[model samples]
Target: MPAAIALARQLSDADNKGIRLDSASLTEPGTPAEAFAVQRETLALNGWLTAGYKVAIRPDGSSVSAPMAHITHASTSGTAGFDRPAVDALEVEICFVLGKDLAPRNTPYTRETLLDHVAAIYSGVEFLGHRLDDGSRSPALLFLADRLGNAGYVLGEELPAKVTEPGQTYPLTITINGDAVFEGPGKHPNNDPVAAFLLFANALTEPVAKGRIITTGSLCGAIPTPPRAAIAISGFTTLTVTAASTRED
Candidate 1:
């Protein structure tokens, strides 16, 4: 068994729960090939713990080479359920969904090939938790191990992940407490978030035999959650959400 899997089982046992990892650990690993190895082991562990998912982000926010990343567990929900009362996170992101469960990397890319997963795309939130004592601040593997660290999923029924054209631009707005946080025409994460998702997906190829979910990355800054706060996102037009905390929940 890989060290990450062993470590995950240990952690899971300790928490009596699933494991989730951070992206920082993979940025500059210590040992030779340590990063890639850790990710694989993490994926292996994820298969045992929960489902899988991905997050593709433009690290540069404007380049496809921004390194598409991934996380764990894909979820489907309606728009009404997006807020702190639903899950816990230091931040949230607005992402689109492809309607199909993708095949492995280098596979043929097409509008039709990516539409089978066919669920509506709505605004979902991802929670970035604080770091712990062991220098583990949610490694990438933990995200895989814990299934995209899925706290709660919120989606709109009218929107669809089914894309007929790759260039379709959707107007989106993400706001918190009435202040507009993110407003832009949502583009595919990598010209095709689905394809971008597949790139990272192929890297950790072990878990998909069962299935996986990809988040592609945040299109903008990660909103900081101060607890008992409100956050919301809308597609085509920016929808809003408000939250209140009693001295920070």
Candidate 2:
């Protein structure tokens, strides 16, 4: 097997079995580009469908994009359930629902062009996880190859289009299992979540289908949670996830 595919399989198998890859056993990607290729192959190997993307801009202004699987959706019943060792942390975010397909073209898409295709704006929570034992301290390329530590996502209520305006800050409060965890003002790093969406759209080498949802980077940094937790985002929405312990039988 190719190194990339072999790495993908190792990661995928670890995920399925609720185990972590030994740091020493991981095959590091040769380059940043190769890491992304490994990510693509990983998705294919697991037969996971690309539902959307998670976009983030580094402090240096460089952007990163990762594909989100269809399984990312959490139930509206104010709960998101995961198996033990599957989810590591949670991030608050803003999500955009696309109303039209954006196919790859010679002409890049602008913020306005991207917004024109948006059907709605939403409050969102991104689930973070990793298959490697020492993923956080791994090389940048290896981290990228691990899907940027993304495990899943939970979309909250639809917000008025006007609320998504650049620089607008939303007062956010997060509680896990009824205990207040994070309370602060949440805003896009670039002041415009739409612009982040546009960046991801334009950078895509493939077409994005209608109804796909793209989530901007975290409003608050990734926060840790318990196995069975209730996450509430005051003034927006609430979600819950029970990370059931895996059975070794």
Candidate 3:
């Protein structure tokens, strides 16, 4: 059996059983491409559809991305779908809804052209969770293959098109059950969402469809969160959602 598919079987089992795997026994992906291949297989084995994508930049300026299978809008009330809620932490981020398809091509996409493909920009939060026992301490390639610990996401309101301009920042605050947790500037990594999104889009081996959402890395970093806490993140606009209360033993 191919290593990617073999490893994906174990991952799918772990996720379905609601338990973490012993990472040392699993096949380790040697490169980012190999890791992504495993991710594709895992998604297929688990019967999860790709809802969108998430991109993040390392301190060294290189980029990494993962697929998100579940997404929720703020306007939708309730916490039923957020089964894994940020057991570790949560992050505030800028999310974009694509207006057009970004098909794989011989020529790389330009930043200006990519921006034109964006339909709207929104404020949102990313819920972080992992299926590895070692959690964030797991091997980098293995972690990447596991979809970068992306449990789920909740998107807030749409912002004006002008907010997509470079160097834009929001004076933001985050609260849990009405208590202030993070209060400061909400900025995109390196102050450029387009650059981050473009790198992920162009690297894709498959096409990304219109209306699919893509979120750049966190601006507020990861803040520890309580299970089922009512979270409200406010900035250019306000978004509130209740975290999932149920937790695994």
Candidate 4:
């Protein structure tokens, strides 16, 4: 895992210095397993606490995940405690909070059993950013190692009802700075809200304690956003972003 350690150091250093890495500078991992190794190292280097997880599955059935460090309430802190680089975009999503421990076991967790483990469903937003320059063209594995471009997660109000099954849809309207940026019905990218969660459940090597959150893939993809924007998503509480400042050195 030396490569993972080296890449993790580069990522952590870039974040500390408020700089973006050129893709060429990365000693990119060769496989998904190696990429996740880099993720573990990066989290260790940054001393970040794992509050939740975010995941997305690729078309090939392989998946990438990020351990979230910052989980905040939209009603109280908004994005004030987000400590990543500049905000790039916000992804509207559904967050499932665990009500029970899911430990590693021999048997797979079925969809029915998994839904029974959820404590609540809440409207959620994923703060997206990258340590790599423009991150779009960077290697997929590198992006995965960078915690799936997750800067933070903001928890909105709880839904009045529960989503007991997958493939549910919701009417979503996102307003930024009092202007409507996106308004439409939103569905999970994979068409199932629990698809990522299922993948996450089966892949865990450690126990996910009760109260840890699992945010599924973006419902409407990433919405380009500016710093310090007041964002309001229909059926959820409003959240304001903290202005991302750059170092002048």
* Cα RMSD to the true fold for all candidates: 7.2, 2.8, 2.5, 2.6
Candidate 3 lDDT over 56-151, as tens digits, reads: 775676778888887888764423235562355688888899899878878888887788888888877888777788866899899998888777
Q: lDDT tens string, model 4, 1-78?
A: 888899989887876676678888677789888988888888888788888999778778865578887788765544
TM-score of 4: 0.89
Model 2 segments more than 4 A misplaced: 70-85, 238-249
Cα TM-score of candidate 1: 0.53
TM-scores of the models, in the order given: 0.53, 0.88, 0.89, 0.89
Q: What lDDT does each candidate get?
A: 0.41, 0.74, 0.78, 0.76
lDDT (0-100) at residue 17 of candidate 4? Answer: 71
Which is the winner by lDDT between candidate 2 and candidate 3?
A: 3
The lDDT of model 1 is 0.41
Clashing pairs in 4: none
- Residue-by-residue lDDT tens digits, candidate 2, 78-186: 6665554567778888898889997877888877777888888877787777777775677777878888877877666677888777888778888887888888787
Q: Give candidate 1 misplaced runs (Cα > 4 Å).
A: 9-49, 57-111, 116-122, 130-153, 158-170, 185-191, 200-212, 235-249
- lDDT of model 3 at residue 3? 91
